[model samples]
Target: MRWWWQPRKQHGRIGRQVTALVVTTAVLLAGTWVGASRIPTRWFGPAHPASAQAALPVDRVVWAWAGAVTTTSATVVAEAVRPARRARLVLTADQAGVARSTAAVPVGGDGIVRLRATGLRPDTAYRYVVEVDAIADHARGDGRFRTMPSGPASFTVAVGSCARTGSSGAVFDAIRAVEPLLYVSAGDLHYGNPARDDVTVFGDLYRQTLTSPAQAALYRSVPVAYVWDDHDYGPNDADAAAPTRPAARAAYSAYVPHYPQPEPGGAVYQAFTIGRVRFVLTDNRSERTGTSLLGARQLAWLQRELVTAARGHAVVVWVNPDPWIAAPAGGADDWGGYPQERRVLADTIAAARIDNLVMISGDAHMVALDDGSHSGYSGAGYPGFPVLQAGALDRPGSVKGGPYSHGTFPGGGQFGTITITDSATSRVGVELTGRTWRSTILVSYRTTFPAPSTPPKPGTG
Candidate 1:
């Protein structure tokens, strides 16, 4: 999606309905718009096929995304063109056959599988291999992911949003190279949204984006958490009032692996804690209204979670799909449009003195780094936290004009990383880094938060 300001003229509208045909045409025709080289080499031909060494009885099993992670459990999602009654997920502490197996449940008729693995050790490293059938085929030869720590620990996370199916996806490689424990995709995983919101269209769109080599490799290795944006949700600028909201929500549920959703029969907006970090991912499109981005129930849930996380976790990561800082001119589709709600959130954080909040967002097709000062509140009213915007993973565009805070870098296949390092003492170091397609650091910011003092030892005096 383009920036809110200068929408029609300067940036051109985000394609209303981004079908495979439209995406191919746009990438081929506008070679100069985003840059011809940015398009994935495989898009000109069929989507990347499985490697020659892939196992038999399956053409290819595409690894989708991973999430619903806890101290002892996590889910892996995948899809295949070949039909299979059951899928196998094997987790091994090492390569020497100390393995645990889990069964996968098939969702819908599209051959999508969700393998929910449990009984995992907390704060441990494990190598995993996903096999479509017990004896037949395996999607990934071997992949590795670390379970979330049960207690205070150090970890890195990659965050980004808005990727079309055809982009070269260099950022995905960069993210994998960083070896983040988790990667949060704020929204817009794919661009194809038919006007009627057909399930077939949704499945096709997902395959086009998820099966690519870069994305598949990333998901195979790193766990992912997702939230939806406008295009992926339905249409351009679509909202909760859309006629096809139910269908869209169902399609998302069928394909994407996520934590238990808070809003039943609506979009997925949920919270999960991994070690010292508490993640609150918001549903921006489904419940959005003129006054609030998140509906009343969701908003209340968020406020309560913020307080709970602030009191306990070393850092609270608030994931919103739209840019929270350096808002554009007219606030139609972003947090800026709903000033009262934004004010309430900011006021609550400030009044509570929640010092360890870091907001990560995507949608603007640019990377923006802000200290929360530009959120339009002043005079100690809004004690702003840091908001990092990692935009347009592969879509065409650069950083546009706005009241960018300390660091704002032009975007083109870029993502953001947040590394939290906990210590024995009462201090936690948090680092935020933004990088480009070729792994160049665009902006890096670091801050330390003093952890709450330990309780006095009982009866010491």
Candidate 2:
């Protein structure tokens, strides 16, 4: 609501800055600049001390994550603890030639703070800190994030989902070790009591997930792009009608550094780009109905995205949190239950003539991949495509959709890595691998997508 300039004093070399910076705060609202945007502001108050904020025991809330990142803009978010008037972001270049910044901005409320920066270089790493007033909050470890790469590039994105509430498994360390450009949490972020609707309850779950030593460290380093599934949204197999969905979404908007959604205060489905690959994350739970998967609004948006995908990007990653192909028997909770809409979606893809689409899904425990085979379910008999099923981050593995050409592994502590190489003269190749908690490869699949003949825009879409 309040948009006014607040002067900041520089603390490091300007040109060498990993990038520029912006910030905002929330007592539960988002503001301008994911150059850090909105963070949840759940203010818990005890009587104020006669002296100052330095001595207050504000340990109830802790943790920070940066996301909604771009070549020139990035957002950092942290939950509100006690009230504070101002907050700022401090960014340090990764190496000698990188850029660093100490852009300061006004904080709107006491408990939460968010800041975003613009004019940052693409694909550069920078360490960050969130300072309240002038003192640094220890919520962010030696945390760092890289802006999405610009132009033809090579990067690795780590993807996983399904962690028990407050799990701090070593798998997180494995994810951080890979140092992927970004981390994608496909769905089921936490298995808390979904029946609870209180915003604070969900907020507390986020706090626990973020503070767990290893997971916190991973998030501190890699920016995350996430969506929710059955367990995290409500009771297992919950649909759009779950009463607690609004509160769940509210917690998500407040806590996660995320992308722009198709609709405000609705499903968290969104799209973003890294190099030439476009990632389309879907909201399956909140929009689910007896006959629809993404709801009417999201389905239309998806059509437009696919229609334009082949013309612009080299690869399209459709992140449907549920299985895309044949769901297992008795699995009516997923696409299997909605045959008509599934046919329509498949038909749409066929009509678009897009062969660059690759699906990444979670919920089914095992990590599996099919190379453009067993992927077509359209009426025209659109024969083939690719699908990467990843997850069970810490849950028991169960196979749901497949007959995958690649073998599937059913076990706990699993994740997937997508290695993308987009070059100027050759085909853009994507390599998908299923791995374990200790980083062992379970199975692998490789596929090729048409690369732009001529150099395309740096960041498509």
Candidate 3:
């Protein structure tokens, strides 16, 4: 809200020339620069010292996750030490005061509170404070999130996977620093013993992983979309036979704020649209079989969603937990193990000619990138889209890209960032940055999406 210009103490000819060059450069890329200027003020907050009251019982209000955010509605998932009697959410356009309040939201006995706040303005920035049972403001959890624009817009998203429970890593802090509009965990949010089917164990794992100061801060600030894989799915390469499958799905419903599952009581496969991009977050572990990765029903839904989105949106992003490329060391955990299903998906996309499609994958332990040449596509030489694999926030070990891998980020512990810039000219620019937990760039990919023709006006066709 405050702006100031500093006067140069002394500017010689050389200084004046440099300043002129800077201004000229800014003018040259003014269209791209326009997107940066629209970023919300104070979208990200600085780290603050915990107040004394924060350490008291009121501190039971631990972390909050924003989910299923559309233009006018958002779901907030808050965690407490004990089942909260009364939970409230105060929303404000500015961080200072409340514009509206959703008071007395019901909290379940599981210490998980889900609150939906509606009637928000589209593409607007809001800061929320969650208070449990008349807790003081200083002790409440506060963070900021922006509703997706109903019209053309530009935004950034950060993603990673395979984070172990009770762990901290630089990747968490780095993700927060990037200040994305949204964050997603492709799968394996926590590694709990897959053999256990107890709801308490799954709940405890989420608490231990998300309540960590660094990870909590990131989730609190940016809205998140979630999809689960093997570990979080209840075992190593768990499938339909996993004993805890039902409990796993139930716990996810109790905690994460996600779009409706493709099927009523099936794996957490859902699709959502934000601006000109549509995202398909798949559940690859559950209902898994030698015949298909998502089973028949979910696969049908995915095909329908992709075809629909391709006709309407400028870009489509598919979130696959397992790598689309051949498995490393002939491992059965990735798409290589489900060759039939992988081919079906690849062929479907190619046949439909879905333009501007980008696939993001997790659960691979190391960051890797590949063009569609190795994406299991058949009936043609290769598909044109790119696949980005990122994760292993706390694990150790790295592998190089094989015959199918184009850019392999060696070493362990990394995250992925996708930045999209929408221009007035109807062109969208995308940049993917793969970085280590320490913020070192390992590989980068860039592409552009030309504007699709607008749909026919209503009652005209």
Give the range where candidate 3 is weakest over 10 consecutive residues by summed lDDT.
13-22
On lDDT, the candidate that comes out on top is 2
- Candidate 3, position 429, lDDT: 82
Residue-level lDDT of model 3, residues 1-461, one tens digit each, is 22111111112211121110012355545533422222211112111111111122347576678988877888888786575687878889853455688867777787688878888888889988787786733343776788887767789899888776655555677788888888988988877756766778788888777676667767777999999988887878888789888888888888888876756566889887777778888888887876667888888888887877777777778998887777433447677777667677767877888778888988776677766666645567446577888765655434523343445643334789888887645677878777765567766788888766772111100
Model 2 lDDT tens row, 80-128: 4466666677677677555455566665453555677677778878778
**Segments of candidate 2 deviating more than 4 angstroms:** 1-61, 96-110, 138-141, 327-331, 454-460
Model 1: residues >4 Å from true position, as ranges? Answer: 1-60, 104-108, 326-331, 376-380, 398-402, 453-461
- The lDDT of model 1 is 0.69
lDDT of 3 at 278: 80
In candidate 1, which residue pairs get closer than 3 Å at backbone N, Cα or C atoms, i.e. clash? Answer: none
Cα-based lDDT at residue 385, candidate 2: 74
TM-score of each: 0.83, 0.83, 0.82
Q: All predictions: root-mean-square deviation over Cα?
A: 7.5, 15.4, 13.0
